[model samples]
Target: MWLKLNKTFFGTGTHIYLCAVYIPPLNSTHTADDLLNLEAEIANYSKYGDIALIGDFNARTGEQADYIENENNSIQFLQDMLPQDYDLDSPIKRNNLDILNQQGNNLLNMCLSSRLRILNGRYLGDSLGYHTYFSKNGCSTVDYAILSKDLLPSVEYFCTSDLNFLSDHVQISFKLKCDIKQYINKKDFNNNNMKKFTTYRWTDVSHGKMYEALNSDEVKNKILNFEITHFVRNEKGINEASKSLTEILDNVASKTCIIKVPIKQKKSKIKKNPWSDNELKDLKSKINNLGKKTKT
Candidate 1:
């Protein structure tokens, strides 16, 4: 099982967590404690984000007529384990049968307690009852697309299709009305386009020329002539003044200094290895000496 949080621009910083899971079959060697542990792990993950746990849980949902052996403990455990935010409502409104089994009853009770409406039940009414899984035994709705209550409004459509040619389970599809925004880092904006000042490495020859330019009569008169009051009045005026100053400095630097292209250094890769007990002891000794050296 794994959880992936996807950020979208529904409002701002809206995240939808997709939890993919596969619970072991009830008849398998997995014990009740194992199932409880799995549920605990899922519950922990749910606290971090809005989650949609989807997978073949192997627990029967009483949405079909097929009389397969029910895993009562697993069914009840999962229903009890899910957080309040999860929607337990069946997406399909009508099943092949009118009555629900033990698993269905437990699921229904869970939904009622959580106040979660089923997406499939809401979209597909009694007339469009569909089965998700098929085999020699019979057709049943085993697979499900569960979502959080917050995501209920964003669900545009939800229905099952007959796309499973090789597999026993059919494909369940749903569309979400959401706008995804691409994440941009602030550091990416610090490129050459944003740079206004020309950078130069200071040397003895360049430093002497820069000193002469700053103290020159022409440069001093230009600085004196610049109107500080005109620039301080508004935002646009300040930008214009800054641009003019940058131009002046760039001209002076070109005349007084030699422009050198910056050298790009290749980063060295450091490989890490697990340290043995002796190595750890040696490292501790080094750290103790460093503290003594600092004191001295």
Candidate 2:
């Protein structure tokens, strides 16, 4: 069973499909059926632009070869090969278990055929190949994050959490590189508490640069044909025109202005809070260190 969530970037036309899956575990009857169904699902979703399959697959594919390399001069399976990493656990040995079952072989074949890469032990967060599932019986990695090899540019990081207070399966997470500005806070009419955004330090930017940008051909052309480009009489047209101009200015400012984030000036002296004495800070640090285990 699985659920799919798709997001399409407006201007770029990039479609990202995320599938959360839970394949039934291997048993006397359902192993073969599950493998076939999984392969079909992959085939169907691979047609989309960029896709990721994530969840507990129940297949213990430990360090198995996900690709079929050059076997002989006679039969050639897939020319596009999976990237090799010597630093990861050896192909002959795995961090969790050396045993490979029938379910594992089925998963390996499916990945090889579908050109999907498992982002478990090789990627950033869980690069140590730590086990993702723990129980009274034993510990192994059953949860995985799989992605189409073509999405290598979009996949930023992959990791698994060690803490599992709720269930036997630990949490797994992966980040996709996208425009952060899209998710930034906007004005909310429902809530009284407003969101704060990083402000621009206009003084930090050069006046000459700002003048040159506004007087550039792109801005001049838009300003000249502003009326012809937009209908300003109606409320909708007025809002549209305002938004277009705002986007243009924001784009230009993004290139020229510095954001007002925390930074140290070389000439300025550091200011210390009045209440932050060395002794108090030491106590606070000890308290924080003690609290981390309980909170995290």
In model 1, the clashing pairs are: 89-118, 90-121, 91-119, 91-120, 91-121, 92-120, 92-121, 93-121
Give lDDT tens digits, candidate 1, residues 1-296: 45455564343234666656465665678566443554455466557655565655444555542222244444567876778675333333434322354544444444444333345444643224466667898766655566666667777877777744437877666777755335544565566434543467666787678778887887776676664436754668767787878767776787587776555556898655565577787898999999999999
Candidate 2 local accuracy as lDDT? 0.67
Model 2, which residues run further than 4 Å from truth?
1-7, 10-13, 28-32, 71-98, 180-296
Worst 10 residues of 1 by lDDT: 64-73
lDDT of 2 by residue, 185-216 (tens): 54543233322344566664456667787779
Question: Stretches of candidate 1 above 4 Å error?
Answer: 8-13, 32-35, 63-99, 103-117, 124-129, 181-296
Model 2 lDDT, residue 52, Cα:
77
